[model samples]
Target: MPNHIDFVATLAPGIFSYELATGGQVILAMDVGTLVKKGSDVLVSTRNAVKAPDLGKLKQVVVQQYDVLDEREKMVRSASAKLEASLIRRFVELK
Candidate 1:
């Protein structure tokens, strides 16, 4: 099994992005303090591997720190969600 998985979370609106390996140590190391300071909404994007049934444990870890959204819910909240899906694709292509 892979020790780490790539996933995206909606931390803010203006594209505050960063990639740091948790080293299989922490499930989420998001700076909630900074997020609070920035007054950004916390919404986890469930568009990809994040919805895998095999990742239930991983999802649990994330759910502890942030709310998990299903596809239907995501569509309902589309106005507030950031465009991390496309951004991530562009990033991966760049790499």
Candidate 2:
């Protein structure tokens, strides 16, 4: 599992735009720079792989990958909000 603490949650999602090899634009996540420059269809791996998946092996399109990223983003937002509220409550008690 990823250390959630490593990420800095933001008030707004970053603007993402990319085109797939199949010819369509949609976006986010993983090695974003490589994806943007190469514009290759991608494989979705819950874990890192030593070898990138073959083009024939890639199943999900760019939009589907973004959907997964979006769900995780929502979770992070909720966690950040809860953390902020708890900190505020503690600060109030301190005052």
Candidate 3:
């Protein structure tokens, strides 16, 4: 993922803002929502919620991929530790 600074820089140079329904107070990004910059330093309101068409399916795929990667990492670490222990035991027996 690109750094936040780099990501923002790529966006069209502009200041962004979003108006909440309850009050006139300008809350930060987290409170109000994601701000998108258009052309100039102009603030454009945007929806915070993702607009994925197949969000559920995408999420399931992502979770499955993460599980596979985690299991692979655990297997590699376990094998490495076992090999290290066997090597140490052999060295001690030779002494």
List RMSD in Å for every model shown: 18.5, 14.0, 12.6
Ranking by TM-score: 3, 2, 1
- Tens digit per residue, CA lDDT, model 3, 1-95: 22233223222322233444585534222113433344434343443222222545445555665588799999999999999999999999999
lDDT, candidates in the order shown: 0.42, 0.46, 0.49
Estimate the overall C-alpha local distance difference test score of candidate 3.
0.49
lDDT assessment of candidate 2: 0.46
The list of candidate 3 runs beyond 4 A from truth reads 1-53
Cα-based TM-score, every candidate = 0.18, 0.41, 0.42
- Over 33-78, each residue of candidate 1 has an lDDT whose tens digit, in order, gives 2222122333343223222223446557456534544655777678
- Looking at model 3, the pairs that clash are 14-41, 15-41, 16-43
Measured with C-alpha atoms, the lDDT of residue 78 in candidate 3 is 100
Q: Is candidate 1 or candidate 3 better by TM-score?
A: 3
Residue-level lDDT of model 2, residues 1-95, one tens digit each, is 12222222222232334456699654432332221111222323223112223332233444466678799999999999999999999999998
lDDT, residue 75, candidate 1: 76
lDDT for residue 45 in candidate 1, whole number 0-100: 39
What lDDT score goes with residue 23 in model 1?
36
